[model samples]
Target chain A: MRQLIDLFVSFFKIGLFTFGGGYAMLPMLQREIVEKHKWATEDDVLDYYAIGQCTPGIIAVNTATFVGVKLAGALGGAVSTVAVVSPSLIIITIISTILRNFAEYAVVQHAFAGIRVAVAALVVVSVAKLFKKGVKDVLGYVIFAVSLLLVFFLDVSPIWVVLAAIAIGVGKALKAGKGGEQA
Target chain B: MIYLCLCWEFFKTGLFSIGGGLATLPFLSEMGSKFGWFTQEELANMLAVSESTPGPIGINMATYVGNTVGGVLGGVLATFALVLPSYLVILLVAKVMERFQNNRFVQSSMTTLRPASVGMVGAAILGVLQSVLVNMDAVRAMAWSQMLSWPNLVLFAILLALYAKFNKLHPVVILAIGAVVGIVCKL
Candidate 1:
């Protein structure tokens, strides 16, 4: 019971504080889940992040679920997922109810204008960090460039990009094995 | 009926929007037009609010749209539906994860996925840049001088420079500063 509450409280804080998006939640998750609670190690968090990217859901929520299940069980998973989303539900409910015509307000618009700029910067920072960690090889760089162009210019679906990348990885592995046998 | 439809749509969104919360934007836009729950302008507002608020943007969006379409009940239902997929998927993965944690195929696939995820994030950055910094309608109308939002561009550059220099400032502080500047300058 104490563990469940701890999971809920920790993830609730993560949900409440993280701003930009799922990626933006990483630092908070690292601090609380990894450093404070010691629920998961840094490597575990990174592994969850990788798995979360491939899975079909919000990355933060997926990570919470993974950690939760690891700590407790299915019930822990349910609690953490709910805890993570609770802040969004409550805040959005309040905003939607109180400010029905949210856009018509000038102050809100200006605030959002400023927030949007910051959000863009946040996204750029996340992209730079991911690029540094991800592009370790020539093939990785090529894949990054190709996928970026494909999504940005051609409006390709990200799922297809991920699928193609998986195929390339498998194909490369097969080719390497063949070369190893020949040598 | 409204509740049911909301659940179904959000469930589909949860099932398909891989990568992260922002990936759901296109689907939400489509839902906006299809359901008439919110206008395109309203969707933009929701995106803004979702960004500034705590929690995953996609879940916030689901709640917002659901509340708009149905009610508080709708909001609850939509949020549950959205997360249901992740709960199930993670549970299943947890079972197999121990066995396959170091499988060659899995490792290679994850390796490739790293770059692909970076690309997706890059695309998301472009989308945000377009929405935040550029006014497409102005560009479409050939109002060349009005295409870029100068104030926003300037603000973005400042923040980018600050981040580049400091590199460790918490994002929340930057957002708070942005809000203050926005309110004071009314930009």
Candidate 2:
């Protein structure tokens, strides 16, 4: 019970402060759980991040639950998951109640303008970081560029892009593709 | 019957929404069109609240849309349905994860997933831009030059510079800056 409480509080803090969503939360997760608390290791966090990415739902929430479960068990996972999400849930609930009427108010309207731009900036920063970290080789770079264009210019369905990429990846693998660029 | 529909839609969403919450947007847009269960405008409102407030944008949307359509029970049901598959799949994968996690096939699949996810995120961002960037009808009514708002351009530059300088800064910090700028500029 005490361990679960600790897990919950730590995750709650993660949920409250984390900006830029799941991927942005990775370093912080590393710091708190792996470095500070010793609740988990660096590899654990990375594994969680990878799994979180491939799986559905929000990466941060999924990650918190994964770590919590790994560290403690079912109770730990539940506590941590809820702890991390409660802030956003409560805040959104309140915002929803107010937003229906207050959204177009002059002040709100003005505030959102700056907010939107900043969010765009944050997105751009994240994209750049992810590109650097994930796209190391020529093939990866090519895929990234092609994917971006397909989405931006062609307006193709995302599912198709994912499927096509999978086919290419599998094709490369079958051909014994060797190199940093293979994947 | 309704719950089944929710389950199916959210299940498919979870399976294909490999990137993250925002990736679900295009799917939601299509679902809205197909089901006639919600409107695009409502979905936008859901997004605004979802992003501003809480958990995953995807989770919040599921709850919001679900609850909006079917009450509290619906929200809970939908939320669970959306996350259920991922949890199960992850739990199973976690078992053999260490052994095969970095295997070539795994890497290749992930590599494939990377671009796909990027495309989805990019598409969602574009969707947001279309809605938030300018008033569409006004742009159509007037010339392109008049539609070019100086505030957005300057704000974009400021953010770009700040981001470049503060490479290590958290994304939330920029979000905070955006909020402050939002209030000040009345944009």
Candidate 3:
């Protein structure tokens, strides 16, 4: 029971504090799950993050669930997931109810305009961080450049981009295996 | 019936929107047109609200759409439905991941996926920049005077400078500054 509550409280804090999106939650996740709780190691968190990126649904929620299950069990997973999302549910409910027509106001419009620019900047920072971590080799850079152009210019679906990357990975692995056997 | 439909729609969204929360934008835009749940402008507003609010943007959006469609209960159902797939899939992966943590196939795939996900994030940044900085439609419509979105550009420049100077400042602080600047400048 204490474990479940811990899971809930930890993830609840994560949900409440993290702005931007799943990627923005990484530093907070590391601090809480890795340093504070010792629920997972840094490598464990990074692995969860990698898996979370490949999976469907929100990466933050997925990471929460993965860590929750690691700490307790299925029930812990449910608790953590619920806890992490609870803040969003409560906050959005309040906004939707109280500020239904707030966006129409000129002040609100200007606020959003500024917020949008800030958000873009935040995303720019995230992209720079991700590039540093992900672009390790020539092949990685090629994949990054190609996928960026495809999605940005052609408006190709990201799902297809991910799928193509997986295929490329598997194909390279198979070729390497064959060459090793021959050697 | 409405609740069921909301669950089904969001479930599909959760099941398919890989990469991250922003990956769901295209799907949400489609939902806006298909379901008539909200107009395009409202969807844009929801995106802004989701960004400013805590928690994942995708989950916030699911709740927003649910509330719009069927009220509070609808919001609850949609959020649950959206997260359900993630819960199940992550559980299964957690079980299998320990066994395959060092598998060559898994490692290789992760190698490729890392860069791919980064690229997707790059696309997400570009999308945000286009929407926030450039009024492409207005420009295309030949409203040349309105093309630059000067206020947003100025705010973006100031914030970028601040970020460059104080590299470790928390994002919420920057966001708060942006909000204050917005209201003060009335931009």
Candidate 4:
């Protein structure tokens, strides 16, 4: 019971301080979970991050679940997951409620217009970084271009695109395996 | 019914939105249009708010949208549903934790999925540009000069330059600067 409460408080702090997105939570995770708590080693955190990226759901939440399960059990995972998002739920609910009421104000509208531009600028940077980080070779470039076309032009659902990528990846791996065996 | 739809949409987002929080943007854009729950402008607003606040952007977005749709219960439900898949998948992975990361299939899938995720986010930039930089109504009416929102474009350029120069400024500070500029310049 005490362990569960500790998991909740620790993750709640993580969620509270994590600004921007899941990636921003890494430093906090390192500081608290690794240095402070000694719950997992640095390599363990990295492994969890790798698993979190590939798995479904938000990366931060996935990481929280992984660490939570490691520390306690399934119940710990649940507790941590809920704790991590509690801050977001409470804070956003308040902001959304207030914003909805004031959305009609001229000042609010103007602020949002400017805010949107900033957000777009930030996203442009993020997408550029993502491309640089992810698109490593010819095959990666091809998948990226095709995926962009499919999503932007054809309006294909992203889930289908992800599934197709998985199939292609598995096929490529199997072909490599066959070649290795023969060689 | 709306609550059910919200659950399903967010659940699917959680299950398939690989990469991170930003990866969920494309799906949220689709959901906004499909359900008439929010407009493009509203989505932009949500993105700004999500960025400025604490926690993961995906969770922040889910709670915001859910709150907009069905009050507090909706917010709670949406957030819970979004985390549900992760909760279950993590539990399963925990039991078999040792071999899971070394498995060949997960590695290959992740390699391919990475680029694909970037592509989706790339597509999302276009949507953001359309809503923030260009006035579609003006374009539809063939008002050439009026089609572009110069103030927004100028603000975008300035922010981009600032980001390029600083390279380490916090996003919240940049967002605050944007709001101050917006009110002063009447953007």
TM of chain B, each: 0.73, 0.70, 0.73, 0.96
DockQ rank order: 4, 3, 1, 2
How large an RMSD does model 2 have?
4.6
Report clash pairs, candidate 4: none
lDDT of 2: 0.69
A59-132: candidate 1 lDDT, tens digit per residue: 88999899999889899999999999999999999988887666579887777667767767765776787689
DockQ of each: 0.53, 0.40, 0.57, 0.82
lDDT value, residue A157 of candidate 2: 63
- As for candidate 3, its clashing pairs are none
lDDT by residue (A75-106, candidate 4, tens digit) is: 88999999999999999999999998998999
Best by DockQ: 4
| Candidate 1 segments exceeding 4 Å error | A1-56, A70-72, A177-183, B1-48, B56-58, B61-74
- For residues B57-140, what per-residue lDDT tens digits would candidate 1 score against the true structure? 888988888888888999999999988998998999988885556656667776787787677667656766887788889999
Evaluated on CA atoms against the true complex, candidate 1 attains a DockQ of: 0.53
| Per-model tally of clashing residue pairs | 0, 4, 0, 0
* Candidate 2 ranges with C-alpha deviation above 4 Å: A1-10, A24-39, A68-83, A152-155, A177-183, B1-8, B19-79, B138-142, B168-186
Per-residue lDDT tens digits for candidate 4, residues B1-187, read: 9899999998998888889888998888878877899888888889989998888999999999889888999999999988999999999998887688878888888889889989988887788888998989999999998999888888899998898678798877778888999999998
Q: Which of the numbered candidates is closest to the native, going by highest lDDT? A: 4
CAPRI tier of model 1: medium
Pull out the clashing pairs in model 2: A88-B54, A110-B186, A110-B187, A111-B182
Q: Is candidate 2 or candidate 4 better by TM-score?
A: 4
Ranking by TM-score: 4, 3, 1, 2
